[model samples]
Target: MLLPIALAVVALGACDTGGPQIPEPPGPEQPTTPSQPSTPQQPTTPTPPTTGTTGAAAPPGTIAYARGGAIRLVNADGSSDRALWQVPNASLAATIGGLAWRPDGTELAFSSDHEMATSWYERDIYVVSADGARLRRLTNAPALDALATFPKGTVTVRVQNLTGDAGPYFVYVLGAPAPQQVTIPAASSRALTFTNVADLGNVAQPVVVINGTNRWFGDAVADVQGGRSVDAGSLVVTAFGGIPHYGADVPFWRADGQRVGFIGSPTCNLMQVAATPPAGPSQSRLLDPAVFGATCAVDWGPTAATADQIVYVDERRFVDAGEVQFFRVAESARSAGSPLLTVGRYPRITDVRWLPDGSGFLFARTNDLLDQAVNIHEYVFATKAERQITNFTGSFVRQFSVSPDGQQIAFERVTDLKGPSDLWVVRRDGTGARLLVRDARAPAWNPRLR
Candidate 1:
C-alpha cells in the first residue's frame, strides 16, 4: 500500500498592513580631495560581474521526466525538448509518481502503472535508458513498490507487500537473478519484527533489525561472527517508548550510522540509542526540552564522509514564524550537547542534500503559503553564505539533486498542480538558470566518476 503524504498548513493570525519595510544597506560615502595641488585623479576600475568559480562552463546536460504516461527529456536550457518514451493507451491509466536517474546518468528508473484495469491500485518499478534506447521492468509481483534508493553501484528498494488483512511486509535486497528477503525470525504471532537496514556492503555483513511490537523501536547492526563461509550475523536491540509512527516519519540514524536518534511527542523530547555488541538494551537520554519543544519535521543530511549534520524545522517567534535549522552532530557529541549550531532560516525546506565536499547543502524553499513561489538555496556551512538559485513566482519545485562536482543543481518545477512539473538547472552562484526536464518528481544525481 502507498504511504500517506504529510501536509504542512500555515495559519497567519494577525496582519500588519501598515508595517514599515526593511531598509536596504547604506551606500559607501564619497571621499574629498585636498585643496593643494595633487596628481591627476585616476578613474576607478569597474569590477566585473562575479561568475561561479566552482567549474568550467560546459554544454548543460539533459533531464528526463514523466508526463501523461510518457517520459520526456529536455535540454538544460528549456529548449529542444522531446518525449523519450510513451506507454500504450491501455497502460496510461496509472499515474507515475517517482523517477530517478541511475548512477551512470545513462538510465532512468521509475514506478508506473502495471495494468490498465488495476491501474489505480497496482504499480511496479520500471527502467529506461538515458537515450530512450532500452526499456525493462524490474518487479512483477502484486506488492506496492515505493521509496527506492539507488546507491552508488547498487539499487536498494523498500518494498511493502500486502499480505491478507495484516500489513506485516518485509524489506528485501535484490540481486542479479533473484531478490534476497531480509527479516528476523519471530517466536510467536504477537511478536512483530521491525528491521531497518542502515548500510549494505558488497561483502557479507549483519543486517540491522528492530524486534518488537508497535510499542517501541530499536536498531540491530549485523556483522561476521561464526566460521560459516558466508559471514554470520549478530543482532543488537535498542528500545524506546511513545514513537510517533513507523517508517520514514521520524529521524532515526545518525550521520555515521553508529547511533540512532529520535524525538517523542507531545512533549517533543529527544532520545538516542548507541549500537553495542551482544544486543544490549537501549539507553534512553533526554535532551533539552526547550530546543526540541515544537512539533517539527526532521531529515538527515546527505551521506558523505565529511557531511555530519541533522536539519529540522523550528519556530523562532515572529522573525522566522516557520524556519529551518541545522545542527552539527560532531560538535554535539564532543560537548555532550543536543545541538551544535543554528544555521540560518528558510521559509520552507524539503529534501536537504549535501555537496560532494560537504562544504554546503542544497534544499528547496517555498516563500508563499500556497507554495506557488519557490527557489533552490545552497547553504554553505564553512562560510555561512546562503545563495538563492531560482526565483520563479508561481512555480513549485521538488525532487532536487546536486551534481557530484557541486557545480550544478537539478529540480522539478510545476506552475499548477494539474500541470506537468519540468526539471531545471542552475549554477551554484545562482547564474545561468534554466529548465532541464519535463514532468519528473524524484531526481537523483549520479555520484560515479563522470
Candidate 2:
C-alpha cells in the first residue's frame, strides 16, 4: 500500500512524523522568511518564444523521484515510469529519501530510515544498482547520513571580513606590490575569498579595506596555510564595524569538486573543507571580527580556464532591504584573487547554475516589487547581459537543474506555497515549456551513462 508522502524524508525536513522522533542534527540555520515551498497546484504549459529554436528533444537520462516509501524512475521523455526501490513491511515507518547517481551511472546511493522501529527511525546510506539489485547498507550510524554525493579534491584558505558595510573589500598581502592585491567583497557578514594569495607562512599579513575609505582592518594576521591563528600586529586600523550574525547553510562544491566551501555561521567566516576526507585532521575557526549577513548560494564556473573560479550571490539587508549582488572570485597564481561584482544588482537572486561551458549561468529572481513570482533568467559573462527564461506569474520556482547538453532546463514550479508542485521543462531560449511530471517534489536527472 502507498504511504502518505514521506514528509519525514530525512533530507528534506524534520524527521519526527509517523515514527519515533529523532532530534535533528545541528547544521546551518537557513533563512526562515522564504523557504522552498511545496505545492499541490496543477502544472502550466509554457508558450514557445517567437525567435528561439524549439526545446530540444528530451535529453537522454532518467529522473529519480520519491513518493510514499518508494523510489521511482522515469525516462526523460516521461517513459517507463516504474519503482526502483520499495521499503520492506518488516520495518516500521520505513521511507526512502535522497538519491545520487554513481559517476558512471551504473549504481545509485540513497538514504533511508528502513531499519527503524515504528517508535523512531534513524537515517543511513545505502547503495543499489540501477536495476534495483545488489542492494547494500553502507552506514549504520546513529545520526542522519542523508544527502550523499561523490567527493572531489582539496583546497583550503582562511578568510574573514572585519568591516561593517557590505563592501567591495580588498585584501592586500603586506609588503606586496599593488599588483599583488586581492579584492573580495563581504559576501554577507563574514564574506571571504582569495586572490594572488601565496603560502606566505609568517610573512602574510592580510589587510582589508573598502574602496573610497581610509579605514583599514588587519591588526591580527596569522599563518593561514598552517590553518592556525597567531598574534603579529603590523597592520593599521582606523575604524571598525559592528559584529554581524553567523549561521550555517549547505555549502557548495568548488569547480574541481576537490573542496566544499560555505559561509560560516554565527561568526560569518568563509570556511572550507576537502571534498573527501583529507590526510590530516579538519579544523574549524571563528573569525567574527564583525558581522556581514548571509550568503546562501554559490555556483562554480565551468571549463578548465575557469575551474578555480566561482560565482555567488549574497544579500545586504539595510541598504534598501532585499539588496543582492552577484560576484565572481577567480584564482590567479596562488591567490584566489578578488571577488568581482558581476552584471547588475537585484532585489533578490537565488538558485545559480553555471552554463555547461562557463559563458554564463541561470538564476531565479523576482522581477517586480510585490515579488509575486520567481522566474528563471540567463546571465552571460561575455556580454554581461541578462535575459528572462521563464515568465510565468503567480508561481514560485522551487528548484531547477540544467540539462546535460545545456540546451534545456528542468524546474519545479508551485502556484501556491501550501499546494503540491509539478515539474516543467523549457528550452534555453525560454520556449517550448511543457509539463514533465505531476506530484513530484525533487526532480534529479540521472547522469548520462557511458
Candidate 3:
C-alpha cells in the first residue's frame, strides 16, 4: 500500500499526503474557508502519467495483510489466508503500518500499535513467524518506529521521522540484539552508511542505507554504544519565498546502497546525494534540473547491471500536461540520466515500484485532480510491454506491494466513504483474486527472508 507516511511523503491539505512525518490533520483550532461547490465530496484520486511499456502473468509466497486487530497471511492467490499474529490488546483497535518479509522468508517485520494508547501516534516495530508464533516486540516506546525494509537478510533497517513536520530522519537497525538509532539532519547528504559494528559488540551489522542532502551526524554507531539520544529536531528552512528546504516526502534510497535521492525543498527538483560512508564525506547534485515540481516515489532496487543504477519516477506536475517521467540513472554513466518511460499525457502517474526480479515495475494510472477511477499497470523491462494489473471502478486502487519473488501482489482497495479499506491479493499475471481483510493500512509481501 502507498502509505501516507511510507510513500505519501508529505500531506498538504490541498496537497495533503499520507506520510508519517505529515502532522495530524490540523485540529479545529486552525480555521479556513475556501471556495465551495454544492458537492462536499471526498478528495478524488489523482491521475498518473501513462507508461508505454507493458506485460504480465505470475504467482508466489504467503501474502500478509491486516484485519480487525490481527496481521494475517494468505497464499499467493488469497487462499489459506490465515492469521499469522494479532495485537495483544484487541480493545486498542491497533492499526498496522508496514509489513516486511525476512530475507529467508520465515519471519515478517512490521510496524503496529504496541499498546492501547488511544491514538495511531503510538506505533512500534515487531517481528513474527510466518505461522504467527513467537511474536516479538522489536521496539517498545512512544516514538514512531515506523518503516522496516529488509534488504536481504535477518536484518531490517527501520526509518523514523522524528518531527511531525518531516524534520530528522532517525534511522534504526533491527534484527540485531539491540536496534541502533541515529538521526540525519535536514539536507544531509543523500547517502548515510552504517558500518563498523565491531566497535558496537556485534560481529556483523546490517548496512543502514539512507538518503538525504544535509547530514549533521555521522557517528551513529559510537553514539548508540555510548547511549546517546538522537534529537531529530524539525524542518525549518526556506529558500524561495515560502518553499521549504525539507518537505514531508520521504527520501529515495537505492537498493544498491550507493546513493540516495530526494526532492529539493523549495525548487521541487530532484537531487541525488551520495550514501556517504560512515562518518565520511559525500556529494549532492540534481538528477535532472529539467524536472521541476517533482518528488521521488520509492527505490525499486538497482538494476542487475550495476549498483549505481536506479529506476525512479519523476513527477513534474507544473507543466500543462503534468508529466510523470521515469528515469534510470547510473552514477558512473556520463549521461545525466537515461529516460526510460513517461506518462502518456496529462494525468499524473504515482506509486511506481520495481518488480521482484527488477525486470519491470507496477504503478497506478489515475486522472488529474484524482477524481476518476484508477487502473493499476505493470511494465516489463525485458518485453517493453505495459499490462493492466487490475480492474475496478468508482473507488480508487490505493497501492500495491509486490512480493520478493515477483509473482503475487498485496494491494489496497479504497472507497469514497472513508470506510474500512479492503486488502486484496492478486497474481502478477492478474488472476486469482481474493480479499484478506478490511481496514488494513500498509500491506507488504514477505521478500526472501530467513
lDDT of each: 0.39, 0.45, 0.43
Q: Considering lDDT, which of the candidate structures 1 and 3 is the better prediction for this target? A: 3
lDDT of 3 by residue, 1-450 (tens): 111111112321111112221111111111100011121122233223221112333345556766656777665544565667877767775566456555455666555544313111234345567777666443221122221221222222223333333443333332222223344443443233333222222212222222232221111222223222222122222222121222222244455434344433333334443333221111134343443224435443534443455565555432645556666665443453545666644544435667766676777766455545555677776666666666565765655677775666677766642445676665566554555555664576666432
TM-score for candidate 3, residues paired by index: 0.51
List the candidates' TM-scores in order.
0.43, 0.51, 0.51
Model 1: lDDT equals: 0.39
lDDT (Cα, tens digit) per residue for candidate 1, span 230-298: 212222222232122121112234444343343332223343333221121122332333443332333
Cα lDDT for residue 216, candidate 1: 19
Query: Candidate 3, which segments miss by more than 4 Å at Cα?
Result: 1-60, 68-70, 85-94, 106-296, 302-308, 318-320, 330-338, 344-350, 367-371, 382-385, 403-407, 417-419, 429-432, 448-450
Using lDDT as the measure, which candidate wins? 2
Clashes per prediction?
Answer: 3, 29, 54
Sorted by TM-score, highest first, which candidate order results?
2, 3, 1
